[model samples]
Target: MMSDENKVGTYPFVAEPFHVDFMERLTMGVLGNHLLNCAGFHAAERGFGIATLNENHYTWVLSRLAIEMEEMPRAYEKFSVQTWVENVYRLFTDRNFAILNQEGKPIGYARSIWAMISMETRKPADLLTLHGGSITDYVCQKDCPIAKPGRIKVEEQQALDEYKIRYSDIDLNGHVNSVKYIEHILDLFPMEWFRQKTVKRFEVAYVAESYYGDTLSFYRQQISENEFDIEVKKNGQEVVVRSKVIFN
Candidate 1:
């Protein structure tokens, strides 16, 4: 049982009022943030964390993420985020997460792909070469049922909105924070839409990085009444990210 601690980690959190939307349900943006923090916590505890890798001029970058939620915790509700490594490859790793309600019932699950990169060259690092490939020791068979992030194409010729990346969007990596893109995509919808429906699933694939002062153009295509595909381009040409949002 003790070995499982090295394989999985569960961190508790509450759906504070500030973390919830006007409907008193936890917002996806905040939930996404918490999920990422759990990833950092799990990795750090296992010695492959960014802080440790940074010492060797290496860092972790998120490549793709997919989150599926059956329900969002309400305000002041107690919940927890559980994370575990699913697989470790040469240059990328698969991580999974579960959001449990107060009763320990899973309300959501997520699957993410990450890569370790050299900060100097900004190139992918060999995961099998790191820490003598001990990262494989943390792999768990625990199930994450959500589908992996799929190809999100937004061929819409019309841009719905445009903005310039600012300091607030930039992270320590000198690029836009992952969650910020989630926030911006959600912003594309009005309260009226959210009032009538709730998000059922969210997925994002980071194709490239966008730095501060870069202009972002948001293009969206409605796949269905409840499904939408979004693409974000830097300088209106280079795709920084693509996303899919499904509502219920």
Candidate 2:
């Protein structure tokens, strides 16, 4: 049996035309989706994926994510993503990912925090107790280049847009998927902003879960000429997610 500590998953993907923006470079949201897909595939192959967790009436939820990049891959560019579990703490697990260009050189990296929650209770489960044995034997010595995403202070701002959760936004957990939150935030920005600036870093903190038919309000604050803060809230009260985008 393969020890969880020794497992590493690598996924190769191409930035198709659809994955790129008007600038023909990969969009931040698409990169987020790819990173998440890599994590899901890695977990599923290790026998601790959604299917196995579902059998136990549990599911994994992303709590926080941060990504930093030197540049975005252009359309039709082939790249590879390597992911591994860094450590499994009491209630949360740390995972890291490396993004390699076609030539296999590091172009970007991401770190994510996740927790296992009961399907019925929707409360976090102690990962150590649930997984049987210690899975942190081979923790990655290297740390993520960027700091973890933190909570954003909501400022007085008018709603930028409104979106009603739909079937496409819901995931297997019966709530809006984490990646969808990034997409919604990106959509609030005009296409011209994407073409004019390149995102150097992106961070998101999942504050709360949202369900289908729920309406979400988007708000934005310009921290600086090249930095912006975004937030999504439910019914103008409960915050669903908060994000920061820094451009170069």
Candidate 3:
């Protein structure tokens, strides 16, 4: 286990068979999950994890994430994820992560923004108000190499599929989990695409919340041979999430 005194934590993981796609490479959703898990584990060790925050009637929520990978790891590949807080604001905090191969070289990086929300009102909570002024002092200066994710432009695209929210998709927030959204978007592509192309970069900005029983419409548009845009909406016009995926 990595220590918390340095303000950075490292967690080891293996790309198990379940973590891979049909192509036997790590799936985007699983990679995102591993990054978040690393962040959560570090936060817990530092006394501000979701469990600790729950005691204070607050929980962390992901706002946006951008990930860029040199290449996806294959099944049974061993890797280490290092995560640290890059910056902390009033309502949100920015965290950066590095995915390293067995040789300890970075194969990918990601940046994510998160907010703490009150369990009672479901409103944003101030970091200072929750943990006092000292919490902000424990930040790591290490920066992510990739740029932060921005708002995705939704263009005119045809609906690809309609999916109904299932019980498994909802998280403790009573809405669909963030990673599930990525899974839904990835499902739009056929198995052949996953075998031929590799995801070089993936960005997602969650907009509105989708609840159980609500049907989401998935849309896709090709930006280029290696780039694509995706959007999810509950109705025809109400957007739930927007994302862009770049493949190599």
The candidate maximizing TM-score is 1
User: For model 2, what is the alpha-carbon lDDT of residue 2?
Assistant: 51
Per-prediction backbone clash count: 0, 0, 0
Global lDDT scores for all candidate models: 0.92, 0.84, 0.87
Q: For residues 1-248, what per-residue lDDT tens digits would candidate 2 score against the true structure?
A: 55544576789999999989888998878889999998889888777888888999988888889898988889999999888888889889999988889999889999899998998998898887776743554355554576666667759479989999999999876889888888898888788887777888888989898999999999899888888898889978899898888888
* Pairwise lDDT winner, candidates 1 and 3: 1
The clash number for model 3 is 0
What's model 1's lDDT at 54? Answer: 91
Give the Å error, residue 41, model 2: 1.7
lDDT of 3 by residue, 1-248 (tens): 23454788889999999989877888899999998889899899888999998998998888888999997788999989998888888888989999999889999999998998998998999886677745576676775778788667767568989999999999877999989999998888887887788889999888889999999998888889988889999967689899999988
Lowest lDDT 10-mer window, candidate 2? 133-142
Ranking the candidates on lDDT from highest down gives 1, 3, 2
Candidate 1, residue 37: CA error in Å? 0.9
Which ranges of candidate 1 are over 4 A from the true structure? none
Task: Rank the models by TM-score, top first.
Answer: 1, 3, 2
Best by lDDT: 1
Summarize candidate 1's per-residue lDDT along 128-237 as a digit string, tens digits: 98889878889888988888888887889899999899999998877899999999999999988888899999999999999999999999999998999999999989
TM-score of each: 0.97, 0.91, 0.93
Q: Lowest summed lDDT over 10 consecutive residues: which window, candidate 1?
A: 1-10
